[model samples]
Target: MFSPQGPSLRELCVQALSSVEHGYDLLAPKFDHTPFRTPQSMLDATTRALSGLGPFRTGLDVCCGTGAGMGVLGALCQDGTTGVDFSSGMLGQARSAYPNASFVRADARALPFDAGFDLAVTFGALGHFLPEERPALFNGIYRALRPGGLLAFPAGSRPPVTSIAHWATLGFDLALRVRNAVWRPPFVMYYRTNTMQEVSRDLTATGFTVRTVPLSPPGYNLVIARK
Candidate 1:
């Protein structure tokens, strides 16, 4: 699933053994080469989907990682784009790639931003937050948006029970549970936890008018929440 330029298996093992923040720091340089990086096509599809909803002013990308989501925000927002992530190494890479865009180092659970952005987007990061953590996460995103502003992210629908991906995801989460049980620093990446019903309920409770926008690339939908 990784390109030749991506982290070696040994390097990935070291990263999996470290804390998420430090692990990301170690993996930052090779991250974009990995399949874990959000694909350009997904970002393009999202931009096309959000274009009608936007042409926004200031944009924010929460848990922005290597700043892939910024492409969408940068295109849609006339003013500027900002990417917030806790890993300094990740932020460094983002800043290097998109120097004109603002990059902030902050945890997603407690985002350090006021209601100042017209639009906010996050990608490939929800699996990092557990079920109980959703409340704090959704609330933080809610607080980061201006009145009538929107927070958006793409989430994959559950793979069919008959599909290989379904079994693979289940096995991965099980392996993670086993690893966390025996390991020191848990790598919190679960693929199948964020269901549409559960996430919509949380977003609604956090004061967003939630809706799902179906899009291309198959089995993916944009979860749009308006304040």
Candidate 2:
């Protein structure tokens, strides 16, 4: 599902064999061209959904890659926006793309913020964290947000087990597992790592009141949590 300008098979293979950070570094240049980038439709829908909750002053785009979600923050947040990511290469691209927004290089697990953001959003980054890691991740997001602030992200409806998409995703995760077992550094992308039920539970445990709203352009759901 990659475009002609997207990574070649060999390049993808090499990336898949590397650690998550390094793989994202290699992929950052062509990330927006791939299906991996959060789609514009979803971005628009999220913006619309968040607009009602906002008039927010400062917004944070967690794991912001290439700054697609920054556009959403720009529309919703009035004072300023910040995009935080661990990958320097990705942050570099985002800086170039959205010069107005401040970009920070930091791990999501240990966000270097203290109740500074009115709204926090992440797109297409949760699957990189295993299910066991959700608590810390959600806790960090909760910590980054100010009291009564919201955290938002788009999650898709699960594909039926009999669907080809389901099987393909399963196969991809299995392949990644095999590669990581024999490789030096593990590429941590897995298709089945995040589930709605688990995510809701984790957010609740982390002191967020979680709710899902259907996003238009289909196949997507918006998970909005308030601290």
Candidate 3:
């Protein structure tokens, strides 16, 4: 699932053994080459989906690893874009790719901004936050958005039990659970935790008016939460 330039299997093993922050720091240089990066197709689809909601001013990308989501904000926002991530190495790569955009190093659970952005987006990073941790993360994002601002992200339907994808994801999560049970620094990614019902409930509790629209492909939806 990786490109020629992506990290080697041994490198990935090392990363999986390290803490999420330090693991990402070590993988930053080769991250974009891996399947782990948000796909360009997904980004384009999200941009098209969010365009109609716009006339947005400054934008923020939470957990903006390598800044792929910034391209979506860049298209929809009239003002500048900013990317916030905890990994300095990832921020460095993002800064190099989008020099005009701002980058901040901060944990997503405790974001620093307060009502400074008209729009915000996050991609392929939800699984990093466990079910209990989502409250703090969502609360921070809610605080970071200006009144009448919007937060958008893409989410896919859960795969069926009979599907290969379902089993693969299940296996991955199970393996990670085992690893975390014995490992010091747990890599907190799981594929099944963030369901539409769960996320919408959380967003609603945070006072966002939540809604969904069909995206480019089937089984995927663009979640728009207005502040």
Cα lDDT of model 3 by residue, 1-227, tens digit: 37788999999999999999999999999999998888798899999888887799999999999989989989988889999999999999999999999999999999999999999999989999999999899899999999999989999999999999899999999999999999998999999999999999999998899999988778899999999
lDDT of 1 by residue, 77-196 (tens): 999999999999999999999999998899999998898899999999999999999999999989999999999999898999999999999999999889889998888989988888
Instruction: Sort all candidates by TM-score, best to worst.
Output: 3, 1, 2
Quantify all predictions' global Cα lDDT against the true fold. 0.93, 0.90, 0.93
Q: After superposition, how far is residue 56 of candidate 2 from its true place, in Å?
A: 0.6
Q: Output the worst ten-in-a-row residue range by lDDT, candidate 1.
A: 1-10
TM-score of 2: 0.97
Instruction: Give the CA lDDT, 0 to 100, for residue 124 in model 3.
Output: 89
lDDT of 2: 0.90
Question: Each model's TM-score, in the order given?
Answer: 0.98, 0.97, 0.98
* Superposition-based RMSD of candidate 1 using all C-alpha atoms, in angstroms: 0.9
lDDT of 2 by residue, 147-222 (tens): 9999999998789999998999999999888887888787788888888998899999999998999999678889
Regions more than 4 Å wrong, model 2: none
Off by over 4 Å in 3: none
